[model samples]
Every structure is written in structure tokens, then in C-alpha cells.
Target: MAKISTTLLAATALIALAGCAKKRPAVLPPAPAEQATEVAPSGSAGDVDPNGGPGSDADFRRSVQSNTVNFGVDVYDIDSTARAILDSQVEWLARYPQVRITVEGHCDERGTREYNLALGDRRANAAKNYLVARGVAASRISTISYGKERPLALGSDEEAYAQNRRAVTVIIGR
Candidate 1:
């Protein structure tokens, strides 16, 4: 009877241990290779270099008032401020017709990954459409949505969220 009780207690302990096993967090799939491109280093919007070489990333960043445009929470609409920034980008693109650019859409860490990805796509297309309408050739532009994966700022606060929710125009090639 003593041996049987010990075996039962051991079995119960094993069951409890099994129930307490840790679970691995869900992993997201990798982004596509074809969609990847080298992004130019970020800098201040006012750091314009009038004598920067033509068709260069520095030229693009300098000639344009800003390479990024921020959006409101859960909103992808282009506001007046975003329009002004895109206008600068359009003007720069006109100066270098051979250049190709990618507009990367990003989001803050608020919603599900799927929801953020869709929203990011819309934000990117909105910027691309605006640029195309303003005379930047459609063929010269491409867009990718990084969703909430690539954030400009990391925090749960409003300030960080504001910075994270943006579309960045990257000069891919000339």
C-alpha cells in the first residue's frame, strides 16, 4: 500500500508539471525578399543641402522638405501637412526622373498584426497616389507595408504612437 501511494503521488506531480509547461510565443512569418530594399539613413527635415549631388539619396532628402509624413490614430487620410510634404517629394522626383522610390507604410503597436498591415498598405497607397497625381510617374514608385513591425518610436504613449504612425519615402535607386 505504501509503494502504491508513492507511485500515485509521483504521477500526480508529473501531471502538474506537464500542465505548467511554458508555451512559446507566436512567431510571424518573414517578409518577402523581393520587397526588401536598402533604406537611406534618417536625418532632420531641415537638413537640406542645396549643393547635394543630383539623383543621390542625400539630394532626395535635402531637396525634399521631409521624407516622412505622419498620420492620425487609426487614420490613413492625407492631411494638409502630409500633402505639403508630398508636394516637396513630387518636386524632387521631377528633378530626377531616373530615380525610383519606395514608400514604406508603418503603424503603431495598437491593433492586431493583420489589421495594422492592412492599414499600413492603405497609408502607403495614399501617398503613392498623391505623388502620382502630382506628376511623379507611377512606374517610378513602389510601396511596402511593414505594419507595426518597424516602428520609428517605441513606447505605449501617445507621442511614440504618433511618431510610429507614418509613411516614409525611401529612395531605392537612380
Candidate 2:
């Protein structure tokens, strides 16, 4: 009876030890390699130009309306390059006869909220001015500044901050 009890205790310990062992993930067969990664449009991913040049006027219009332009880099103090990009953006706006746009200005998370708001306002105004200059009609182009309240990227690095500091062009109406 004593021998049988000892054997049972040893078997139980072995069972527990086996149960505690780390189980490995099931390995599946290797998948076939593809020649290239296919680009597909989703919520965050914008459409890519298959032709590889600046897309067509129609495509540009779609892109502008879809919030594709990032005019937020602080690298430009003169702001002419930003203006020129916006000029092109407004040109794209002309294609959609009834569509109106709202330029939402943003800033990097480096500054105070109030200061960032002011900076963002300036950025939006710059975009608005360019659109107005290009004959987009002042009424059609409204401006708003989110400041640093809404950052596109959360990281503290320059690359992330650069992307966060942008004025996005949004299509408000048909």
C-alpha cells in the first residue's frame, strides 16, 4: 500500500511538470515569396500613382479632398514652398465645382498650447491665402487650427513631429 502511494505521488508530480512545460507554437509550412508588395488603399494609406509621376488632375482633386497634403513642416520659414504646394492644391480644388475645403492647421508638440494654436492658425491662414490667390473663392476655403491638440504622430522624434506639424486640407462639402 505504501509503495503504491509513493508511485502515485511521483506520477502526479511528473504530470504537473509536463503540464507546466512551455508549449511551442505550431509551425506551418513556408509561404511562397512574392515579387513585390502590393499597395492597397485603406483608412490611413493613400492611393499610389501607378504611372509614378504627379497624378492626373482628377486624381489630385480626389487626393486633396481625401486629406492627403501635409503642409506642416516648420522647415520653411519663408513659407513660399508651402504656398506653392497649396497653390497646386487649390488648383486641384477647382476640378470639383461644388466641393468646399477646410484647412485644419496643426503644430508639433514642442510648444505651449496657446503658442501652438497661434502657429497653427498662421499655417492655416497661409494655406487659405494661397487658395484665395488661386481663385478658389474665400467662401469655399475655411480655416481652423487644431494646434497641437491633435497630432498625427505621437513620437517625440523629428520624423514623427514633422508629420504631426502639418495643415491638412479636408473636403467639407460636395
Off by over 4 Å in 2: 1-81
By TM-score, how accurate is candidate 1?
A: 0.72
Worst 10 residues of 2 by lDDT: 28-37
In model 1, what are the clashing residue pairs, if there are any? none
- Residues 49-156, model 2: lDDT tens digits: 333322332355555443434554553232665666676676666655455566778898988777878888888787777678778889877777777777789999
Let me know the TM-score candidate 2 reaches against the reference structure: 0.57
True lDDT of residue 113, candidate 2? 75
Q: Tens-digit lDDT track for model 1 on 61-111?
A: 777889999999999999999999999999888877767888989999999
